[model samples]
Each structure stands twice: as C-alpha cells, then as structure tokens.
Target: MTRWLGASEVAARTKSVMKTTLRSGTGRIHFLLRAWRPISSHTSPVDSSDIISAVSPKTLQKGGDNGNFKQDFMKLKQPRSSVTTVLQSGNSEAQRTSITKLRRVVKKLCKSKRFERALEVLMLMETQNKIRMSPADHALRLELTIKVHGLLKAEEHFNQLPNIASQKASSLLLLHGYVKEQNTEKAEAFMAKLKGLGLVVDPHLYNEMMKLYVATSQNEKVPLVIKDMKQNQILRNVLSYNLWMNACSELYGVGSVELVYEEMLSDKNVQVGWSTLSTLAKVYTQAGLVHKAFAALREAEKKLSSGNRLGYFFLITLYATLNDKEGVLRVWTASKAVSDRPTCANYMCILLCLVKLGDINEAEKIFKEWELDCRNYDIRVSNVLLGAYVRNGLLDQAESLHMHTLERGGTPNYKTWEILMEGCVRSQNLDRGINFLNNDFAGLKCHD
Candidate 1:
C-alpha cells in the first residue's frame, strides 16, 4: 500500500530539487525563453514586420495573430544579453520597443488567457531585463504556475522563494490556489500554518477560507471563521460579511439570514452592495415573502450602476423567480440601454426568465431578436427556447428551431442533443431518441 504525501511533505521534498534545478539552469533561462522563437539560431537583422506582429497595440489589445504569435515574440539580438541592452542599443528603430511596451504585451496576454505565452514574456522581463519581482509579481508567478502546471508545482515555486515563511502575499496566493482547487484538507492545513505565521490577522485570508467553506458545503464552519475574526479583532470587510450571510442563508431560515444582514449594516467598515440585497431577496422569495422580496429587489435596483450589467442580470433573474414578467422586461431593457448590444449571455438570461414565467410567445420574440443580431451562433440560446418548447409540449417548434440552428452554422452541444432527445422521448419517437443518444456519444468520442 502507498501512502499519499500531504501538501507540506510534497513541498519539502520538491523544494531542494527545485532550488538546485533553478540555480544550475539560471544562466540558460534565456534559452528557455527563446524556445518559442520563430527564427533560426543564426543572428539576423530584426524584421520590423515581426516586431509589429508581436507587440503592436492592435495585436496586444485583441490578442490576434497571423498564426505566428506564440512563435514570434521579443526579437532578440543575442542569447547572452538582456532585452534592456537590445532596446537601449543605438538602433533607433529597436529603441521603439521599450520596457513599458513589453509589460503591456504581457498584461494583454494574461487578460486574453494566454498563460503560457504570458509566462514566457514574464520570464523575459525577469531574466532578460533583470527587473525586480514585486510581491504582486510573485503572486502572479504563483498563479501562473498553478494555471500552467498544478498546485504541487506552485508549492515547489513558493518553497524556493527567499524567506518563504514570512512572505504573506505568496502564502495567501498558495492558500487561494488550494481554495480554487477545493482541496479542503490541504486548504485547512495551509490556513492553520498561515495563522501560525501571523498572517491571519488580515480579513482577506479569513474571507477566502469562508468562501472555501461555503463552496464545499461546510456552512457550519462559516460561523467559526467569523468567531476567529472577532477574537483576532479583525475588521470584517464587505466580502467577509457577504460570505457569512450566504452561509446563513443556506444553513438557516430568513430570520437568521436577516440577523446577519442587520449586523452587516451596523458594521461601519463594510458597505452593503447590490449583491447582498439580491442574496437577501432570493431568501425572501424562497420563503414566500413576496412583499419583502420586492422591497429588497427595489433597493437592489437603486444600487445598480449603469455599467454593471451583472447586477442587472441578477435582478432580472430574481424578478423572474418572483413570476414578474413586467419586472423581467424592465430590467432587460435597462441592461440593453447601458450597452452597445446585448450579449448572448444577456439574451440567455432574459430568455430563461421569460421561459420560466411560461411566456412562450414573448420568449420566442426575444429568441428571434437574438437570432437576428447575434454575431456568434450560440446553440445555447437556441437550446433555451428548444427546451422551453419541449417542456410546453410544442415539439414541432423545437424541431423547427433545431433545423434553423443547424442552418445558421450553430453546432449542437451535449445539452442541445439532450434537450432534443427529451422531446423525442416525450413524443414516443424511440428511433430518433436512440439516434440522438448515439450521436451524443459519438460527439463525446470525437471531443476526446
């Protein structure tokens, strides 16, 4: 029988190896950076087109490339020298690519979810430019490590840091990684260790732990986090109170949740937002307190900013849950007024709301409106109406919508097939239902 190594044990074992490996390979780190280079080994004049393609504002903003972005980044003159030297050289054209420009490119890559490419550029910034890594940068590197590799590799990276025990940011970042992975055991142990390191005084750490507990269905542990915060005299932030309220909502009744809200309101340090009100309204709606739910929702609407479509989404959803068609349409119109055009997500939200209210005609009109203006052919939007039609015993409309989706270049996802199969089974069309299930399995195979 093999025993599994705990997080600490794994960290300890990997630390020495990681340090030794890094030390031995520090000189050749630039080579690792250049592995993505599109050019040959021989030194050639830097092509302006290559430079433009890699770090231009348009390229950075949109993260689009002519199938060569991953391959052609940071035109280097030599392997031994820093990018700083190349940029500072007498070549005025090369001087255009400043350190700031490189940093911007890295930021864009990160925003676009190109972590591997972002890591490569970040390595260039560090090894090639000899830039100092700030605390935020350390946290970023740890996050990147978690993304590219896993929690274990991130642990190894953290362990290799100088004064590893004292660095709060890196420690918290690792804790966040554990939380994100939902490894309750390791997260608990690491959090305990964090407290010993005198880093638990910050409410952010406690908030993260509470969020983890809530996510993992450990609602009972959420109050314990609050108790720990009170004992430590840590001032609760908005997020901290919100998590407590959420946990209360899950584990107790509306009254218990309301008490938490009252306490949050009294806390001068924390300002309640539209999110808290929405959560409260959800609880109220569930409890059949229509008047109270409506009151909370009204307050939540007032708190909404024009640019914050998320609040509108939540509001629209809750209004639908309350069976208010007028409220749903009102919020949907508000959302579109603030933006250039409604996103597929926005259409889905309202479509779901209308469908839930049993307003098939209104939902169909909304679906048609989406079908006309949607840049991307999202089968999900069509599937919402398709599922609605099937649930309402309108199998013909569902079939017609399915055909229309196929004509519009929309590919059927698993949910699409499942919805259609459900309709087929309801109509007693066993042959087509069998075909759908087979097709779904085939799709899975092709995906794999």
Candidate 2:
C-alpha cells in the first residue's frame, strides 16, 4: 500500500534536500530523483498525478480545465473587468476550479506579453478563491506585477506577502527584475541577502547575477560568478557556460574564449548546441581568425536542428560578415529545404544578406520570388531593395521601385519615407525632399 504526502510535507522535504544537495557535489540526476521522495522510509510514495486522477479529474486537467479555458481567455478583450465578472457569473464549475488551472491561465497570458490581463487573472484567483497561494504562485504574480506596473510596485506587492519573501522563487524573481532594470546596487544587495538566507542554491540565481554583470559592462565579475557556482557545488547549465564564454571573449580575447569552450565541451552534463558553436564563430570572426571562424561555422551547421529558421539566419549573416558569398548562398538554399514556403522575415533576412554582399542582381531575383509567392503586398520587403538602390546611387531605380510599390497597394512606412528622403538629400533635390516631408507624407522628418 502507498500513502500520499501532504503538500507542505513534500515542500519541506524538497527544500531540505535541495539545500543538502547544494552543499554536496551530488549528481544532478541523483539530486532530482531524491528531491521529491516521501518522508516515510517504509511506505511507497504515491505520484501527484495519481492523486489528481483519484480526487476530481473535472476540477483540473493538468493545470487547466482543458483547452477551452485558454481559448475563452484569449477572446477576452477587456480581461481586467471581464475576467472576474465572467468567471464569477454564477458558473459553479469555474468557481470550483483549482488554483493550478487559474495559475496556468495567468502564465499563458504572461507569455504573450499580456501582463495586464495576466495580473488581473492572478488577482481574481487569489481574491475569489479559498485556495492557498504557494511561493511559486507569489513569484509569478511578482513577475507579472513588474511587467504591468514597475519594480517599485512589484516590491510593494512582494513586501505585503511576507511569507514569500523568504522563498527561493519570489526572491529570484525580484533579483531577475533588478537585473532586468540593470540596478546594480539593489541587485548586489538583494543577492547578498538571498545568499545569507541560503536561497541561492540554484545555478539560475548565479546566472541572473552573471547576466546583470554582463549587461552593465562589468565583464570582469562574470568569472567570479562561475567561481561562486563552483564553491556552492551548483551544477552550471548551458547558459552559465555561454555567458562566461561571452564575457571571456569581450575581456580576454579569442584564446580565452576557446579555453572556456573547451571546458564546456568536457563537462558531461551540458550538451553543446548550435548557438554555442555560432557564438564561437562570432568570437573568431571578431578576432579576424577567418579560417577558425569558417571551421566553427561548419561545426555549427552540423549542430543545427531541423527546421530551425533562426539558426540558418545566424549562419547566413555570419557567412556574409566573413565575406563568404558562397557560404551565404549555400545556407540560404539549405534554409529553403526546411520550410515549404519561407516566411517574409526569412525573405527579408536573405535579401539583407545578399544586399550586404553587393549582389544586387541576386537580391532582385529574390525580390521577384517574394513578389510571386507573397499573398499580401509588404512595403517593408520593397524597402530592402529600395534602400539598396539609394545606397548604391541608383536614384532612378529607387524612384522606379517606390512607384512600383505604390502601384501594388503597398503602403509606405516611416522607414520607406526616410530612405527616399535620404536619396533626395544625396541627389541634391531639396524641393522633392520638402514635398516628401510636407505634402507626400505628413509628419515625415527630413534626414540630415
């Protein structure tokens, strides 16, 4: 027979185990398996999923009332007022819904930058329900509050919740907010407080501190963060290694960066990904090691996952930076194989790379291809070729392209106007520039 542990009992044991693991050089796999074990030595532990299944399946299905709740939440235009009214409008099902379901909804909204709505949902869940708010929940609300309001308001909210201040999650969120604002004094002070409380057991906390150092151009402090992680026996993740390598590149040059890379490769836990290789290539390119950069890029290509558009974009841009036109074309061709039809952004990326390489003829061919495949006329796409013409002193071609875009129902944005204004000034056409600024496009500023 198995017995289920109370939530509080499980949480206490987990926290204690985490602290113990932090002090020891325990394997991450071993630590993770031990972290959630039951307090009892004899009885087997019942899984939380099984408990949820036995209790009430309809109340929540894996942190939600299923997909319908998310769809309904998304349809809410005025979530602040509507969320509470809709949820509490004599709907017994919603009224009886679990906090986990509500928290998941809040997270979904937050992920989409709908912080105002997310905050509202979280507030409603707390005020309307009898369910207890955990430390993680408090942390989430802190993050949302920071996004919706600011750090001051978020701190006020955090201070009001005295119980959560001691928890790792909320404190980490506050530190993250401090880091995001680049508040060095507050971040360092708060970090010291967290360390004193023994809440800095996780590598994520150290990563956040390292990120703050890097962001504020305090690159020398990054290695110190790695040292702290080592002292604390916290296993460093990929982000940790990446940030350390970047700081090394900026402060110590390519050789030091390569040394960091070598250390990361030897680490049994961290899987070396494409982005890491790309970073190496970037560092090599910046140091003027063309052969080394090419070698790194080739390795990066093999590391790239299937259908990764962003990875191809990085490779294409790097190849262009290295003036390897063949490499750029090759990556672009490979990129097309990943998708049935490339996105407008993909077309734009390739166009920019081709234009940078001074392959205007190739760019023109791509622009035509985009024209044929495009469902909607995108003015931004035309601006790429138009800007290329203006930059190359082809004022006539620029004008023709502008007129062509106008005829195709493409509306000119501020960028398109700015390009034309720049072209006019370069060609000594003051009257045309004035006309563009005044009559043609209202509120268009003349470029100097």
Model 2 agreement with the true structure over 339-367: per-residue lDDT tens digits: 55778888998899999999999999999
lDDT of 2: 0.75
RMSD of 1: 14.0
Per-candidate RMSD vs. true structure? Answer: 14.0, 19.6
Per residue, candidate 1 scores C-alpha lDDT tens digits across 1-448 of 1222233443343344334434546646666687644422223444444333333443333333433333344333222133434344554444444444555556666888867766655555555343556666667777787888789988887777656433677887788888988899998998887787677768988888998999999999999999989988999987887788889888888889999999999989888889989988998998899999999998998888887688899999999999899999988887875755778888998999999999999998998899889898888899899999889888778767776776677766678767867876787767656654553445333432
Q: What lDDT score is found at residue 93 in candidate 2?
A: 51
TM-score of each: 0.76, 0.75
Candidate 1 achieves a global lDDT of 0.73
* Number of the top-ranking candidate, with lDDT as the measure: 2
lDDT, each prediction: 0.73, 0.75
How does residue 177 of candidate 2 score in lDDT? 89
